[model samples]
Target: MKFFIRTFGCQMNLNESEIMAGLLINDGFEWTENPDEADIIIINSCSVREKAENKMYGAIGGYGKLKEKNKNLIIGIGGCSAEKERDALLDRFKKIDFVFGTRNVIDISNLVKRAMKGERFADFSDKLNEVNYSIPKRPFSKHHAWITIIYGCNKYCTYCIVPYTRGFEKSRPIDDIINEVEEYNKNGFKEITFLGQNVDSYGKDFGDKKPKLDLLIQKSAQFDSIKRIWFMTSYPSDITDSLIDTIAKEKKAAKYIHLPVQSGSNRILKSMNRRYTKEQFIDLVYKIQKEIPEVTISSDIITGFPSETEKDFEETVDLIKKCRFERINIAEYSPREGTVAHKYFEDNVPKHIKNKRLQYIMNLQKKINLEENEKYLGKTLSIIQEGKAGKNNTYMGRTINNKLIIFQSQEKLNGSFLKVKVNKVSPGPLYGEIIEIINNI
Candidate 1:
């Protein structure tokens, strides 16, 4: 049998899809890139943004048409959006044969078995039945892999749906995570990222001897084969001194921090239940910069929240100018069902206004990106080789601080690390000349 999986949303969703692919491959199924040629079609979707949700529905409809030509084709929906809709998803998407929630990824093989037998199934239970770490996976990058250090989120930010869809914080055992990293290293993978919804709160759910994130980084650094360690999406209030210290002191750990500050206005932040104030967030960014002046700080920002006024929008703009973030992911707020903000707060912000605010923030960030990239002109940057960027021998890679650089080079450096001298700077990517290979990936 052949299966094809289309993934949407965050890195966690991508990871989950990869796991699903692994399970299918182990069940003696081959993967097909084209849905029309596959026996099964799976959509791993996200519901954080209304745009993503609409995409899911549109994809289902398109796949339904494809199913008409192939009578035996089985269609499945999984992840946040599927979990949110639950059993109702089957009713809404009449062509779908099965639905699996985020927590149901462990039983995917069994679900597929039942699905193949013509038994319709919808598993929305909130059980965290995780598969073993040794499962075969089709990793996105041969040299880099993601280790889910923890699962789910506890902070029920009013505007967020991850807490309800993915459930509460469930930290994986440190030994298990370590073993996974070690295995990746042994398999010739040079980079390993520790991932969690809130990585800073990794060991908090467990007993007193809860292993610290710093310890995990330190132990992973001791691995002989691995060259890079990265992590992401730290809650502002959960970041600790030790975490900053580890990143600053450890050579293997990348010097990039992804701490999201949803909004800049204190009133709007409170409305979103973000827990930290704008002043506190600024202070935290300052602290991170103080510890590691060369750190590349990235952030997530949402515009046009419920009751967001022009003054609140101006505050966000002012905050961006003050902090000068290296990179910013801006999103226009859309009320999701079952979230506190959805239930209590009115979606009073006009769509046009929301779009205008989003564009304003993104435009500002583009200038910042250009200015920031300009600073690296004539400086040497260490970059890992990503695949080809375009035709004419154009290749791409990212610096340690997470800046993508496109350069002209004849050498094939797919997974290798090389130092490049920055020649030109633009808003989109850095142009550089390869100098020498640092580590052959």
Candidate 2:
């Protein structure tokens, strides 16, 4: 059997797709990149934004057409969106052979086998901390991999569906995470991103005796094969001084942080249950920037929430201007069915208004980003060459600050570090020419 998996959303979804692929491969299934050549087509989805949700529907519709072409092809939907609306999906898509939730991915192979035998299969949203089902698998990349340090979220932010869909907090054993990293190092992977719903809250599920994130970074840095370590989706409330200090002090840690500040207005934040004020978030950003000069920060911003007024939207714009984020992910709020906001708050913000607000945010961000990139002109940046940038001769890579740079180079530099002097800067990407070769590891 052949299988193809399309993934969307955050790193967690990507990691889940990796595990699902591993399971199928272990079951003697060959992986295919083309959807048309596969016996099974799986979509790992996200529901954070309405756009993502619509994309999932479009993907399903496309698969539905493929099913018409190949009646025997099994279609499966898994991940956040599937878990959130399992029953509705199963009812709507009779052609869908299987639907498994985020929690019980280990059952995929068996479930698909059952579905192939003319049996219907649907398992969505299981209990938290139920079992640790770790499957050994190959990564899509040779140089980088994601290690999921924790699963699920305890924080029920008003607009988020993750807690209900993925269940509560569950931290994998420290030894398990360490063993996985060691194995990746042994296998010649140079970079690992410690993934979680909230990375800062890693060891809290266990007793305080277990080492926290700072200690984990310290231990991972001790390994010679691992050159870069990073963690993502940090919650503002859990981000501590020690974590910032550790990243600044640790040589191997990436100098980028993706701390999400959902809204800048205190009123909107309270409605969203973000737990931190704009002032506090600004202070935290200041601390990080002051402590680590090379550090670049990214943020998640929601433009229009329920009851968000013009003043509230302006506050968000002002806050973004103040922060001057290196990269900002902007989304117009979409209410999930079971979330706190959906039940209590009316979707008062009109579509046009929401879109206008989102545009305002993006427009401001464009100028800020251009200004930030201009600072890098004529400076040497060490970048890990990723691949060819589109059809152009230029190769693409990211600086240690996680800024994307496209530069002209005759030499092939994939999976290696190169030093490039930035000559041109744009809001989209930095255009440079490779001046020197760095570590080829």
Point to the candidate with the largest TM-score: 1
| Whole-structure CA lDDT of model 1 | 0.87
Best by lDDT: 1
lDDT of each: 0.87, 0.84
Q: Total clashing residue pairs per candidate?
A: 0, 0
lDDT of 2 at 224: 85
How do the predictions measure up, each by TM-score? Answer: 0.97, 0.95
Residue-level lDDT of model 1, residues 11-102, one tens digit each, is: 88888888889888988999889888999999999999889999999999999998889988899999999989989989887889999998
Model 1 root mean square deviation, Cα atoms: 1.6
Compared with the true structure, model 1 gives a TM-score of 0.97
Global local distance difference test of model 2: 0.84
